[model samples]
Target: MLTIFLSALALAVQTTPVPPQTTQLPPAIPPVSTPAKPVVEADLRPYVALVTDLGTITVRIETRRAPITATNFLRYVDAKRMDGFQFYRSTKSWGPANQLVQAGNRGDARKNFPPIAHEPTTTTGLTNCKGALSMARLNPGDATSDFFLLLSDIKGFDADAPGGDGAGFAVFGEIVAGADVAEAIFNAPISPTAGEGVMVGQMLEPKVTIKTARRVPAPAEVPQGCVVKAG
Candidate 1:
């Protein structure tokens, strides 16, 4: 009977199934991150205000591109040489679409500075577009204090422009504000028999005086290295 009992216990143990073991997984590694690029700031340009009897016309001078002309203009402003100058010429008769206003010492050699080196549009990459501030000269490198503000895009004044003088006018700055005042000056009265050559009948009878010209604060919102384009 003891042998029979031992045999039954052995049979029961052998018939029971063994439990299966679970396999363990390794931990996942995190991905590597890339570094971000740094932000760059814009380069701001200089601004000047021309307070006129009609209104104020603000301009942004391109010192980087037209250093010679722009510096010359700033010199005059700093010395107060343009304080009593006038916008004496209006080319409205050129056509309703073509217009510009001229301002400076008005041939007052006493108030004039020496002529500056010519900065052609080719070199400066500037154009005589609307609201452009360009130097007026009889020949290359003859520009003095006289300058003009365009009320229209005069591509003919661009260097090497087709059907235009090879040496175009030097554009050093652009009107940023008070273009309306410029337009008003352009539409002002003209003399019937004033001016010479093509300038005849294009002279303003009563010139618009530049009450003051000084460097004003630049707009904070304007980013640095920003290029001012014509509106």
Candidate 2:
């Protein structure tokens, strides 16, 4: 079970004021005296297939709790614009076991679209467990499309800070398949210029490209919750 500290950090990524609905359908008419159902942490069955130079890894994401973040990611996947994007930032020298591996080029000033709000780990009720996929951001409110996959279950990131609620990173998805493939990327030699000070040379292969990120419709009626069952 996820601890309160971990859950609090996950919610940080919950979109503030909530993003305008991504759906095209009209909003549900409010019923007089009917309080809105409290939002629950969602187990989004949204799946992403990352085709990297080494191999492919499939991830099942939870969207119920982090709807905005999930929707934003699906938008990119649907657009088929994730091809050839690179994981420009790799910070392995920090954290336990030098455990972080981040990737997201959808925010490159020249290649990325407009930025999205920061999704702190707190708001989502998720945690930085092993193989967890979290968004990468320079600061709160600047996230675009970059993300990081945890090699080790680092709990230090599971909290909200004053500036961003410590909000750490938003973990919206988990690697359901191809964990070995992810590790291949994590264990790949770190290049000298993968990231700035301390993180430099932390990339497995500085030139390793994500190649493509495709979205496949999840199986129908999958349970929508935050906890991922062991595969």
Candidate 3:
């Protein structure tokens, strides 16, 4: 009877459930540092050149940034439409210091093309800085063959400002060289006859012209530099 009781107790103890052992894993090792992503630099060298007959003017076109405006300018250039076009306006509003020169005559029945949508500075990431080149427009989606070059920094004309109608002018290019030529173009004589037909309220001189324009190959890499001003 004692042996039977002892055997029964042992069997009961063996059948009881035992608590599972908790596991403590080893600390995880951190990964090593990796290289950072490379910065995407825009190539602006192919845009460097002289507009010729206007002095040694170096131009910088922003095709990657301002595709529409740049493409418009290039279209005219490729078609030889701007070869003999005139710089019809030179506003005294800027004076010599505020040198603002304009060219193009898409409004003319003889030289007109279909209007294009407004590509403001905000769209192109270009500003109306001194020597900046911007598309000319009346209302949104009305840009044609006209463009303007800033003689002085015109902050008021920026996109989303009072002048831009919340959509500032499109800036596709800049004068990288021959600022003196730009100055000369700025200082060219003017007639008082309200300039070109398109430039109402603003005066026009019809003094300068786009003797020629061409599309050189784009650069493989962007050149680190700033516009070289005249002495």
Candidate 4:
């Protein structure tokens, strides 16, 4: 979202003799087409379980909408690369209440893979609501394996306006179970001077270790649409 690229192409034109006089007609205006809203078919989704020391959190990924983001996360799960990962950062200082526990590789360059494209909420039709799962990226198409869980609704993360951060983080999934566990990690102890800048006091003192992550069956009672209902 923060990056932009421009390319120019040069075309060669040959001069030709013209007749005495000729009439030219103005070009016809092209018709405008409206964009159709994307549907999140439940059948196209896949689920994963984050087995952490706190507890197990089941997540239902919206494969139909955030395919790249969801697939990027599943690659880590299938490769068993998420094992021993830790929720190293907790941004309770972000608001008056503690919300969300940040995890993934925790900034280890070796653990990172190629980043995926930025899928804005406007295009995906997925809101940054409570229990929503989103991809973390430095810029558009820079998201790799790192992600976060929303403990509450935060629509500001969605595309702010025409030129917003490509409509915020790409929400690929949502928590369907283990809300208590996510909350526990969100409220875990933090070091006052650990994280960088404003996130200093928000970093967890003892990072919560992710015991294991594996693919699981999608919940039978999942509500239709791209978002996961907060457990």
Candidate 5:
């Protein structure tokens, strides 16, 4: 009787049905990404317009990088001391064609201000490259009103440049527009007997006159191909 009861209980327990269990899971999250920053460019360089007999040549002055030289050039512009200036020299035969054209107060002491301290390329990080606007000096710190515009890269004018004086010319600015005008000035007539020493054959016969020079607003955008890099 006990064996039969135990067998009956086991058969009843094995035959009985059991319910299944289900678990709840949380939803998966989507990935998030960060946005990229926009690029911003600003040209805080100062601009100056030179109205000459040939045409207007716009120059961008590196005031921040070459404060002393830039400020000295601006002093003459602000005082109208450069009104009657002339581009009287062209060194097209120096090393390469279309080398440079120089202009100033023609060494008139009355029109020139006191000389400023020398600003080397080591200090300003500028160079005597194409379209460069640099001061003319017999020696460092003697540049007064004379300035020149280059039409080709002349590394010899840079401080520590190979085969050059460690203290080179100070390049304070560059031509931003009317490079054609500068070229015309460079190709102007040269007096065979006007200048002295090495400048004898480099003097402009009739000299291109500068009508006015004044500050102007920066261009909406830097002209294409108007890139300048520090030396």
Candidate 6:
């Protein structure tokens, strides 16, 4: 009986099934760094002053937000591209006591520099509000040295969506000082049946001359985020 029981126990042990084995996976590799988006300084906002016949209109170029656009504008300035350009057009009646003044080559094909990339509000988060400085572009990425000064807060001009007419204009800075000068240009007389489309009769009869546009350090007295010249 002991021999039979021992033989039965040995048989039961042999009949037990074995569990399936799993291979250990190697440690997962970390993801590669993205290449399209590069790191840029987040706290560098510079200023540039436009000396016009009316007065000096200083704009705070938003380097942190719109680096490409700001750099493009500075390229034109450093190259003395807009020295002789003028505020040639103003669009009034869009808003009461407010308008947009267009300044640049005044349709001079010879004065334009190479067009820069379009920095829409969608990318920069900058809006077409009062005192905003925006590049005047016919189509996206078609803006050269021409820019506009907003006299009123116009949300319609701000970039609401990406591509297909909603990309809007590339606003790089704002009129920190000499808003009075901008207002003067806004109120300047317009020609009857002279301009095309919405710009009809919105052209400044005598364009305000821009004597110079240069980079200047901001004074300690003025606001930090803005730029202005002291008397």
Output the number of the TM-score-best candidate. Answer: 5
Worst 10 residues of 4 by lDDT: 4-13
Q: Each model's TM-score, in the order given? A: 0.80, 0.68, 0.67, 0.74, 0.81, 0.73
Clashing pairs in 6: none
Pairwise TM-score winner, candidates 1 and 2? 1
Judged by whole-model lDDT over C-alpha atoms, candidate 2 comes out at: 0.69
Candidate 1 structure quality by residue, lDDT tens digits, 146-177: 99898888888888789877888999988877
State the displacement of the C-alpha of residue 215, model 3, in Å, after optimal TM-score superposition.
Answer: 2.7
Measured on C-alpha atoms, candidate 5 has an lDDT of 0.87
Worst 10 residues of 3 by lDDT: 222-231
What is each predicted model's overall lDDT from 0 to 1?
A: 0.86, 0.69, 0.68, 0.79, 0.87, 0.79
Compose the digit string of candidate 6's lDDT tens values, residues 1-231: 999999999999999887889999999999997878777745456778889888888888877778888888888788887888888788775656447889887656777778888888877877877888888989998888888888877666767743447888778888767789888888888787777898777888888988999988764454543211122
Give the Cα-based TM-score of candidate 1 against the true structure.
0.80
Ranking by TM-score: 5, 1, 4, 6, 2, 3
Per-residue lDDT of 57-104 in model 3, one digit per residue for the tens?
Answer: 556777777777777777777777776666666776545555587777
Q: Return the number of clashes found in candidate 4.
A: 2
Please give, for residues 1-231, the per-residue lDDT of candidate 5 as tens digits: 999999999999999888788888888777777787787767687889999999999999988879999999999999989998999999976868449898998746799999988898888877788889998898998999999899998778888788888898889999988899999998888998998898989999899999999999976666633224533
Question: Model 6 misses residue 63 by how many Å?
Answer: 1.6
Regions of model 3 farther than 4 Å from truth: 1-53, 96-98, 106-111, 162-164, 196-206, 217-231
- Candidate 2 TM-score over all chains jointly: 0.68
Worst 10 residues of 1 by lDDT: 222-231
Candidates, ranked, lDDT: 5, 1, 4, 6, 2, 3
lDDT measured at residue 218 in model 1 versus the true structure, 0 to 100? 79
192: Cα error in model 2, Å: 3.5
